[model samples]
Target: MIRAVAFDVGETLVRDDRYWTSWADWLGAPRHTVAALVGAVVAQGRDNADALKLIRPGIDIATQYAAREAAGRGEYLDESDLYEDVRPALAALYAQGVRVVIAGNQTARAGELLRALDLPADVIATSGEWGTAKPSAEFFARVVDAAQTEPGETLYVGDHPANDIVPARSAGLRTAHLRRGPWGYLWADTAEAAAADWRIDSLHDLTQIVSGAG
Candidate 1:
C-alpha cells in the first residue's frame, strides 16, 4: 500500500512558464525560441540546462544565477506559479491520512518559496537543501527517509522520467510518471517512463490511485 506521496516541483506542481520566460527576457531572446530549444534539448536526451548552452555557449549558469539576483531578476515563485490541481489534490491526499511530500530538483530559494505558500505537505525539500539531485540513488533514499516509510510504500511523482521515475523505481519507491510538461509529454510512452508503477496526467488522479492501492 502507498503510504506517502512525494512530488517534483517544476512542471509537476509548477508550470515553469515564468522560469523559461525569465531566462528569455534576461537573454533578450524571444520566449518561443528558448522554449523550442528547451524542447530540442530534452528530445535529444541531453541535460535540460543544455538549452541555455544552446543559447549562449560557455555560459556559467551558477554565476549567472548570482548575477540575476544582483540585477533584481532572480528566481521567483508564488501562488500564481502553481498549477490548478496542486492545492486541492495535495490537501485531499493529506486529509486521506497519507503523507504528502514536495521533493524536487530545485534550489534552496525555491524550497523557501514553496514553504511560504504553505502547501499541504508533511515535508518540502529541494536538491539544493539535500545536497543531492535526482537521478541519484541518494536523493530518492532521502525522499523515502523523509516520508518515514519503506521504499516500496513511498510514491514519488514527477514529470521527468529520467529524474523522477527511473531513479525512484531503482530505489524501490513506486513511481508515478506525470505527463504534464515537455519532458513528460515527449517521453511519456518511452520504455523508461513505462517502467513507472503508474502514469498520471493530473495530481487529482492520485486520489484514486491511493484508494485503489488500499
Candidate 2:
C-alpha cells in the first residue's frame, strides 16, 4: 500500500520548458541549443548548481529577457510560476489523502518561488536545504524520513530516469515515470519499456494509480 507520494517539481509536476524556451528566444538561439548546452553540463557529472554555473552566461541573457517581461507588466517569469500550471492536479492528490512532498534541487530562491505559487509550506523538501541531490540515496532517504513512511510504502514520480526513477528505486520506493517529451531516453520508447513501477501521461492519472494500489 502506498502511504505517501513524492514528486520532482520541474517538468514532472510543473512545466519549466517555457522558461527555457523563453530564455532561448530572448538570446536569439535555437531552443535546442540551450537544451543541449544544459545537457552537456549535466553530463559532466556536475550538480545542478554547478551545471547552472556552466550555463550562467546563457542564463544571464534569459534573466534579461525576464526583466523585459517584467517591464512590460507581463506575468513575471518566476520559478514558482511552474507550479501554478499544476495546482489543480496537486489539489486533487491532496483531496485523495495522499501526502505530497517535493524533492528537488533549487537555489535559495525556492522559498520565494513556493510563496509566489501559493504552495503550502509543508510539502516541500529540497536539495538546497538537504545539501544533497537526486540519484543520491541520502537525498531520497530524507524524503522518506520527511514523509514519515518506509520506502516500500511510498511512490516517487519524476521526469528524469537517472535523477528521479533510478534514485527512488534505489531507495526502495515505487517509481513512476512521467512521460512528457524527449527529456530522457526512457521516454523514447513506451512507458512500459521504461520499466517504471508505474507510468503516467498526466497528473490526473495519479489518483487512479494510487487508488488501484490499495
Candidate 3:
C-alpha cells in the first residue's frame, strides 16, 4: 500500500498555460511561436527552457527572470491555475491518513505561492528551495525523506516520464505517470510510461490506487 503521495507542480497539479504565455509576452514573441518551440524542444529531448533560448540566443534565463520581475511581470499562481481535481483528491488522501506532499521542479517563489494556497499537504517543496532538481538521485532522495516513508511505500506522481517516473523508480519509490498534460500525452503510450506502477488520468484515480485496486 502507498503510505505517501508526492505530486509534481507544473502540468500535474497546475496547468502551465500562464507560465508560457507570460514568457512569450515578455520575450516579445508570438504565443503560438513560443508554445510550438516548447513542444519542439521537448520533442528533441531538450529542456523546455531551451525554447526561450531559441527565441533569443545567448539569453541568460536567470537574468531575464529577474528582469521580468522588475518589470512587474513574474511568476504568479492562484487557485485557478490548479487542475480541478487537485484539492478534492489531495484532501481525500489526507483525510484517509495518507501523507500528501507536493514536490516539484519549481522556483522558490512558486513554493511560497503554493503554500499560500493552504492546500491540504504535509509538505510543499521546490527544487529551488531544496538546491536540487529532479532526474537527480539526490532530488528523489529528498522527496522520500520528506514523505517520511520507505521508498517502496511512497508514490511519486508527475506528468513527465523522464523526470518523475524514471528517477523516482530508480530511487526505489513507486511511480505514477499522469496522462493529463502535453508531455504526458506525448509519451503516455511509450514503454517507459507503461513501466510506471500506475498510469492515471486524474489525481482522483489515486484514491483507488492507494486502496490496492491498482
Best by lDDT: 3
Per-model TM-score on C-alpha atoms: 0.97, 0.72, 0.98
In model 3, pairs of residues that clash are none
Per-residue error (Å), model 2, residue 19: 4.2
Which ranges in model 2 have alpha carbons more than 4 Å from their true place? Answer: 18-32, 36-80, 83-85, 184-193
Residue 7 accuracy (lDDT) in model 2: 82
| Model 1 global lDDT (CA atoms, 0 to 1) | 0.92
| Predicted structure with the largest TM-score when compared to the true one | 3
List pairs with backbone clashes in candidate 1.
Answer: none
Q: Write the per-residue lDDT of candidate 3 for residues 76-186, one digit (tens) a residue.
A: 999999999999999999988889999999999899999999999999999999999999999999999999999999999999999999999999999999998889999
Q: Which residue ranges in model 1 land beyond 4 Å of their true spot?
A: none
The C-alpha RMSD of each candidate to the native structure, in angstroms, is 1.1, 5.2, 0.7
12-129 in candidate 1: lDDT tens per residue? Answer: 9998999999998998889999999999988898988898988989999999888998999999999999999999999999988999999999999899989999999999999999
lDDT of 2 by residue, 48-106 (tens): 33434454545563366457567663223354446443677677778878788877765
Our tally of clashes for model 3 stands at 0
